[model samples]
Target: MATFDSFFSKRTLIGLALGQFVSLVITSTAFSSSELSRRGISVPTSQSFLNYVLLAIVYGGFLVYKRKRSLQIKWYFYLMLAVADVEANFLVVKAYQYTSLTSVMLLDCWSIPSVILLTWLFLNTKYRFRKFVGVAVCVAGLVLVVFSDVHSRDRGKGLPHFKYGSGGSDPVKGDVLVLSGAMLYAVSNVSEEFIVKKGGRVELMAMLGLFGAVVGSCQMYPEILANI
Candidate 1:
């Protein structure tokens, strides 16, 4: 009875609700990216560019209203963070061009282990035995997913079949892109968490929004030109 009550506690329920909301948003983004790829449109950077712009406008407005004399964190640090964030978004969205949505979502779990290691090494975070067990389970699941993909490819004899998006797309390449993006996501998440804890959420968001928009814009320019 106590365990059940704790599991369904108000805070726990709220957390679960928030988690589901985030999951829905992420799934929707993946679906949109896949749909665009199906229609032969692959502007991954452009898709994320507007989001950064919105963040800049909203949070940056708050900072301007507060009228702080100087930023708590250095501008260059945010620049690096934004670069990682932009590349992470780019790679994950781009993965939809060559992989199944299911595979992209599953392989994106690679960020869990990456985040664990990053926090431990950079932030000196300590984990309990249960946390390690959880991470181990996640890794095992990822291994099984990879094995299944490889087995499927073997059975198909390396022929390009319509598994997900467009025909002739390579799932392996997409998986690699997702994993790479996941690593960058881990880096960005850890750094952002640390900075936010030390500084202020408003400042962090404003700077990230500012730098992310610039970085995303720089990358999207070439993409736009290529598409044109």
Candidate 2:
């Protein structure tokens, strides 16, 4: 029998938390977008902006209560992080305006390879041959999916509920947006990995929430004013 501390170690807890966080984020994003679509409300950018605000509020409050300390990163580095993070969310959410969820799901895995390459180049991390093979496999799978989508699209059965008018609903444009968003997300994740690993930063989640809140709110200001 294992001891309680051994079973519930910090690493184990962190892993569990990370799994839960990823699942929650994915589920929430899918649910929110699907529900909004059902209601004919196309405001993914606005929703994405608000998500950051809520995260900032919740994490910032927690940080203040737990540590009561301010974060101190260089302005330029922080600016890069904020821009990458904000653009990642904004672009992905906005992609939904022009593309189907299926295409988004297939393309968003772009971050896996991007992060692997980034870590290898910037962080001097080395991986086994098997890992490289795994990446190649993933790429091959993605290529197949793309080809299939293209075939179906040519057959006039690509994506359902697709609408094109003055409103945004171009599948090609949406695919491009999703790919761009995925690449941006890769940049943000790579930057975060560098900051946390190389820069020896702690309380990363809190910092992200706070910065996201600030950046997201700033972007959303015009929309807020227009709505008001």
Candidate 3:
């Protein structure tokens, strides 16, 4: 009871509110991405590329001004992290082209379990039994979500834009993409956590922005050329 009461602390409530706000922002972005796809504009890489540029200009500039401090981690590590982050963002957004926003959001929860496993395996993190129970619950929820999508399709109630087995929009393919992207997101999140703990938030964001911009630009240019 005391442990539960601690969660009601003002600081904790503030943290919870901030986290919820971030979640809402992310959901809003997902809706925007889906709307873009619905409009026949599917430039997932381009979208991420612009965000990376802004991050680079904002955070990267801070790092440049603080020239006294050098990077704590190696550049190659940030390069790998940037690639994973960029690809994860691209895959999740691209999935908007093939699935309902609801399914995409629900399936993205796969990242929770992926993160738990990665942190346990690579970071030597340990969890209590309740954490496992939470994970099991999440898995059950995901199973039900997939089953619901399948049932909807079988009943011909799936979205008109996403017909099962169709080349243009396959829900199964989109789900797979979301799961793949979630796994990559786990990798990026774990790596970022490790780097931030060792170095600092500024260093992590600066390097991530710099490398992410470069990687995003490389992927974006080809996508633009293909569209043209």
Q: TM-score of every model?
A: 0.91, 0.75, 0.90
Q: Could you give candidate 2's per-residue lDDT for residues 1-228 as a string of tens digits?
A: 789998799998999999999988996786677566546665555676666666667766766787754555564676668778887777777666665676777778877888898888887889999999999998887776556555555555444564432123466666676777788888888888777764344455556666776777778777566555
> In candidate 1, which residue pairs clash?
none
- Candidate 3 lDDT, tens digit per residue, 106-127? 8999999999999999999999
Best by TM-score: 1
lDDT of 1 by residue, 50-156 (tens): 88898899999999999657887888999999999999999999988877788889889999999999999999999999999999999899787666665555566
Runs off by more than 4 Å, candidate 2: 1-21, 61-72, 157-168, 198-203, 222-228
Candidate 1 versus the native: TM-score?
A: 0.91
Model 2 TM-score, all chains together: 0.75
lDDT for predicted candidate 1 compared with the true structure: 0.86
Q: Which parts of model 1 are misplaced by more than 4 Å? A: 1-6, 157-168
> Which candidate, 1 or 3, has the higher TM-score?
1
